[model samples]
Target: MNIDSMIDESRIDDMMENELIGFISTDMSDEEVLAFIDELEAEEDAREELFDHFAN
Candidate 1:
């Protein structure tokens, strides 16, 4: 999936609200979040199954 099109402020907010995702610090900025996504995407097996595991 295209991360740029797949995620946005609203989606991140929902993830945080539902505790579906976590951050090391509450002070994280949007840039940091995008960087994290980039890091994940760089991994060899960052597949839909992995994402589904987290979503569920």
Candidate 2:
């Protein structure tokens, strides 16, 4: 369930096998990945709100 471990194990090289493995690995319980994306989106939304507030 650890991505650092997964990242280490991931065969991310300049080849088709590496590319396939990267995408395929995502197929298994990508919760942490989704959560990271959600956090990024929330931070972006907050920044936009702050900017608009100050610009007004």
Candidate 3:
């Protein structure tokens, strides 16, 4: 079995869609939105690092 094929693209899509929906529905200022996005990026980076550590 291919490891790449085991990853669920649809789940990622759903998670991103949920985040976008939350962002659109909020009344945050531009700076706040930028900060929120940066936070999300940081969390995603951490998750990727953890996954890589376990994968290796």
Instruction: Write the candidate numbers in order of decreasing TM-score.
Output: 3, 2, 1
Q: Alpha-carbon error at 43 in model 3, in Å?
A: 0.4
Clashing residue pairs for model 1: none
Question: Against the true structure, what is every candidate's RMSD?
Answer: 8.9, 14.9, 3.2
Candidate 1, residues 25-52, lDDT tens digits: the string is 5587888877776665454134545666
- Which of candidates 1 and 3 reaches a greater lDDT? 3
**Candidates' lDDT values, in order?**
0.56, 0.52, 0.68
Q: Please report how far candidate 2 places residue 14 from its true position, in Å.
A: 24
Count clashing pairs, candidate 3: 0
lDDT of 3: 0.68
Model 3 TM? 0.67
- Candidate achieving higher lDDT, 2 or 3: 3
Candidate 3 residues 1-56, lDDT tens each?
A: 46573464455546766896777545778888788777777776676678668878
Number of clashing residue pairs in every model?
A: 0, 0, 0
Q: Which pairs in model 2 have colliding backbones?
A: none
List the candidate 1 regions with Cα displacement exceeding 4 Å: 1-20, 44-56
